[model samples]
Target: MLKVYNTLSKKLEEFKPLEDNLVKIYVCGPTVYDYTHIGHARTYISFDVIVRYLKYKGYNVKYVVNITDIDDKIIRRARELGISPQELARKFEKEFFEDMEALGLLKADYYPRVTDHIEDIIKVVEKLIEKGYAYVVNGNVYYDVTKFPDYGKLSGQTLDQIKAGARIEPDLNKKHPADFALWKKAKEGEPYWNSPWGPGRPGWHIECTVMSMKYLGEQIDIHGGGTDLIFPHHENEIAQSEAYSGKKPFVKYWLHTGYLMIKGEKMSKSLGNIIPVKDFLSKYEPDVLRLLVLSAHYRSPINFTWEKAEQAKSSLERIKRTIERLRRIMTYEKLHIENLSLDEKEVYERVCELRRKFEEAMDEDFNTPKALAEIFEFISYINRKINENKVPGPLARYVHDVLMELLNVFGLLQKFEITGVSAEVKPFIELLVKIRDKARKRKDWETADYIRDELRKLGVILEDTPKGTIWRLSK
Candidate 1:
């Protein structure tokens, strides 16, 4: 069984979806006020792996990540850009999809935007108000925290604790300082929608509650986002959703990913240290970025730096070299001439052990770094056997199959397109290999060595066998 770290219980609980073999997940999506950064990439990529692994294990996953198009941040940004909020949200949503695609994140089952669900949001607000869980004052509607006995259960804060810690603002209409807004009155230059009380926009928390329930149902299997959103955001979502639905639990599992820090500081745009996903992906391959993010546990804070990225690139190249070398051995017909040996059995056992270790790590709260280490262990074993000339055909095929399966679970090795290498170069390398074979046959060591050195300079390596010479791309 897959075990997940549920933030609700603060424990690693075995994942049991509400429906058998089906997982309904709702991830709080980007606010769309600005470009997505590496911090955003880290969260989405981490969740993407979760979804991928669930599907890999034969669980049907319906992943829905909402787009918060109508919000205070979007309104403020639209005003700054001198454009309509819809136009602003549309532009940024396009950019967000492009970045996500580049990062190899699978498209979520539903991309429910808040603007499109205003009716549903209003319906929830109306229900809460009718049930005495919400009240309207001065054309603004707010959820009455006191009415909900379990208001702060998600955040582990009681009403008194929140009231004591909350910064008191000049809102005479609110019954208590701990109460949060469900709808904000429209200002002169702000975006507004028609509501029962007046023209206003849905509050941040209510939007998620309405949209998630509208799309996924009353209670979802998993609700996830950055750890920073646990307090006010997720806490409010739980309050409003359970109050409206009368459900004991609004979400079955709450998963939060840790933030990305740079040089011991949190990565934020206001700090001017934010790295956009597109900007980072331009210099490094998407798989390299995945490697870097997966190098750390999802629940642990990852420190971003150029050195870490470089190491990830190097690590990916090492895996690629092993893959290429294994491909060469798998396709060599003469290698099948000998009986599969005991070393081959050992290699198979090692591959199976690595697979088991990888699964164990992932099951332990998605410990991606430890799982990645296991993958590298398999790579090392395959390369050692290849170098030792003991890689039988069956063993080589087994390695390839196991590696692909593990990489698929992590969403790596999916982009196996031979990049930066021309198709014409392959024929040229093959011709050179044939010529080198002829020279070796004639005992022309000097000429063969010259050809080999030239090919090496051209980023090609030739392994000479008794039958012939095989060429592969050199790292």
Candidate 2:
């Protein structure tokens, strides 16, 4: 059975979906004010691995990530850009999907937008008001924290504590300092929808509660997001949901991934170090980014750096070379008739052990870095055996199959294509090397160094091996 570290219970608990063999999950999506950054990528990719593993283990998983198309941020940004709210949301939604697809994140089963479900949001708000859990003040409706005794259970913050930490512009109509808005009265020159209390828009928290309930029912199997969302966002979700449905638990499992930091600091716009996913991917391959993210445990913070990405790229290239060499050896007719050697048998056993270790690590709250290390260990063994020329045809094929299976589980190795040097570029490189060799023979050190420097700028790396000069693309 798979185990998950639930933030609510503060322990690793065995995963038990409300319905057997079927898992229903709801993930909070982007607010669509700007382009998604690397932090967003980390959270979504972590959840993608979880979903992929669940299907690999024979569970039918239904994943839903809501699109928050309406909010104060959206309105503020729209006003700044001098566009309609719908236009602003549409532009960013397209950009968000493009970035997600580029990173190989699977499309969620349902991507409900708040604008499309305004009727349902209104209905839920109306129910809360009728049940004495919500009150309207001066055309704005707010959820009364004083009415719900269980308000602090999810966030572990009492009303008194929230009051102490609260520092927003005071409004006279509010009953308490900690209460949050259910509906905000639309200001002049803003998008407004007709409601019982006048023209207004749904609050940020109510959109998710309504959309999740509309698609996945009142109670879900798992509710997941970043750890930063565990505050009033998720806490309010639980309150409004349970208050409306009279359900004991709104969610069975609460999973939160840790933050992504850069150089020992949180990545944020205020710090001026926020890197967009598109800009980052333009400089590095997607698989390299994936490996870098998975190198750290999902629950731990990932520190971002270009050097870390380079290491991941090198590791991935080594695995690619091993697979290619194994395929080439298996195609050799002379190797087909030979019996497997003792070393080949040892490699096969090591492969099995590595697979077991990978599963064990993942079964323990999705420890991806440990599982990734196990894969690297297996790759090292295969590389050593190939260098010694001790691998047989059948054994080589087995290793290739296992490598592909494990890599696919992490969405790596899906685009394993042998990159050949282009005919034109190959000839140019050969010509330059020949000239460089002539220059070296004549002891023209300046000319030789210039040639090497130019090629390096063109993404070509040259190495001096005993066999002669070897060149490859700079990963």
Candidate 3:
């Protein structure tokens, strides 16, 4: 059975979906105000791997990640750029999807934008007001913290404790200092939608509650995001959602991934220390970045450093080289399964054990690092078997299949396959490489350089070794 660390229960719990065989998950997505950074990549890729493993384990999953197209950050940035807020949001939203696809993140089943769900937001707010859990102060509506006795249950803080840490809002009309806004009164020269209270827009926390509930239902199997959202963001979501639906539990499982830090400090825009995902992708292969993120436990902070990234790249290279060697052996070797050598039998048994161990690690709270260690061990064993010539053709093929199945579970190695290249093109690419090499031998510098540069533009990267020139697909 699979187990997950639920932030709400503060313990690892056996995973059981509220609905049989169908798992519904909602994760908070980007605000779409600017280019997405590495922190965004870390969180989304973590959840992507989780969903992949869940599907691999034979459970149907419906993943929803909402787009916060309407927010203070978007408005502020749009004004500074002299563009309409909608225009700016659309631009960044497009870029966000590009980055996600480039990183091989699984496409979210639903991407509910806040602007498109205004009616749902209004309906939830109306219910809260009718139920006496929310009030209209002037033109704004705020959820009364006192009305919900379990207000701080999610964050594990009392009302008094929350009041102490709360940032004092200028709206003294609130019933209590800890109460949060459900709808904010529209300011001058800002976008507004007509609501029961007046011309206004939904608050940050309320948009998620409405979108998640509207798309996935009232209580989802899992709700996840960065741990920084646990406090007021998620806490306020609990209060408003439970208050509206009168459901005791807003979500069945609350999974929070740890933060991404740089130089022992949390990565944030305010700190002016952010690395864009595009920059990382341009430098390192996408799977290398995925490995770097999955190297750490999902609930543990990942420190970003070039040294660690280089190590991850090397690890990926080892896997690639191993697979290449195994392919060559499978293509050339003859197999006698009935009379296997003792060494080949031992290596095959050990290879089968690695799959069991990989599943065990994944079952225990989705331990990706431990699971990856098993994969590395399998790679090492296969390499030794190949060197000793103890691997039969059938056994080598089985090992390759198992390795690929496990690697694809993490969404690695498969995405880098060169597309649009045909079987007939291989000999031509080799011919071009040979022609380029001959040009270099004859000292035809211009032709050789032009061919190399043109081939790069066609997504082929050429590497020169003392043995020969090797070519591979570029990211």
Candidate 4:
């Protein structure tokens, strides 16, 4: 049985979806106010692997991630850039997906934008007001946390503790300091939508609750984000959502990715240690970054340095080299089943055990660090068997499939494959693809088109889709 570390209960619980064999997941996406950084990748890639593992286990997963298109951050950033919030959000939203694509992440089922769901948000805010859980003063609506007796249950804080650390919002008209805004009245020149209480936009917390409800119903199987969101943001979401829907639990499993740190500090712009996702991708392969994130347990802080990235890169190359070795061996060394030696038989049995142990490690709270260790162990053993020429051709093929299957489950080695190109030249092909993408982005059509035509001659086909650009060797 699959298990997860639920932030809600603070326990490792067996995962059981609300509906049989169907998993509904809602991960809080980026704010889109600026370039998506590696910190964002830490959360996105963590959940991507989790969801992929669910699918690998035969569960039909519906994953939804929301884009905070309009918010205080977007507005402030836009003002500084002398552009409209919508324009700034649009630009970064495109760039954000580009970075995600470059990382080869599994696309979310529904990337609902908050700007697109203002009407739905307004309806929920209005209902909260009618239910006596929220109040409006001076055209700003605030959720009265005192009315919800179960407030802060997700963050494991009591009302007293909540008040003790209450955030100071601009609206002092709220009855309690723990109370949070449901809707913020429009500023003089900011974007606004028609609401029951004049013109305003939904607050940060309410948008996730409303969007998740609109897409996946009230009680979802998994609601996840970074651990930083466990407080105020997710805590406020729980309070306001349950208050509006009269639901006991707004989410079934609350999962949060551990913070991504750099130089013993969290990667934040204020600290001048932010590494943009694009910058990281340009420096390393997509799987290298995924390897770094999965090298540690999802709930453990990932302290990144150049040494860590280099370590992940080395490990990834080892994995790919092993897979390539198996592939190369498959074309020869045709030993019959009956002709197999005792050691060859043991290798086959070891391969089977590798799958079982991988599943076991993944089952226990999605323990990726252990799961990865299992993969590496298998790789090391199989490589030894290959060196001895003891692996049968069919066994070699089986090992290749098993390695690809397991690595793909971790969202690694899923992008470019070695078909027409040799293993040594694959990195060069990937580099060309990246360069062409950049050229296209810069509107250097002459260079972009030149690369595309040259690559076409070299049997590389670039397929552009809504998710992002992907390349393949033409069969």
Using TM-score as the measure, which candidate wins? 1
True-structure lDDT of candidate 4: 0.87
lDDT of 3 by residue, 279-389 (tens): 888899888889999999889999899999999999998788677656645743555655778888887788789889999999988899999999998888777667667
Ordered list by lDDT, greatest first: 3, 4, 1, 2
Off by over 4 Å in 2: 167-169, 331-341, 421-475
TM-score of each candidate structure, all chains considered together: 0.92, 0.87, 0.88, 0.87
What TM-score should be assigned to candidate 3?
A: 0.88
* lDDT (Cα, tens digit) per residue for candidate 1, span 242-304: 989998689999999998999998898889999999899889989988999899888899989
Name the lDDT value of residue 226 in candidate 3. Answer: 95
Report the C-alpha displacement of residue 149, candidate 4, in angstroms: 0.5
Q: Is candidate 2 or 4 superior in lDDT?
A: 4
Between candidates 3 and 4, name the one with more favorable TM-score.
3
Clash totals for all candidate models? 0, 0, 0, 0
Give the top-scoring candidate (lDDT).
Answer: 3
Tell me each candidate's RMSD, in Å, in order. 3.1, 4.8, 5.7, 10.9
- Candidate 3: which stretches are off by over 4 Å? 166-170, 331-339, 417-475
Worst 10 residues of 2 by lDDT: 331-340
Model 1 residue 327 CA deviation (Å) reads 1.5
lDDT of 4 by residue, 1-475 (tens): 8888889888988888899998999999989988989988999999999999999999999999999999989999999999999999999999999999888888999999998999999989889989999999999999998898888788888877766764654446978887888899889999999888999888899999999999999888899999999988988888878888888678899999988998789998778899998888889988889999999999999999989999999998788767766775674455466766799889888988999999999999989999999999988888777767777688798778888999999988886456667778978977988898899889999998999889999887776645445566553
Residue-wise C-alpha lDDT for candidate 2, range 334-398, written one tens digit per residue: 43323556666677678789888988988999889989888888778776677667777777777
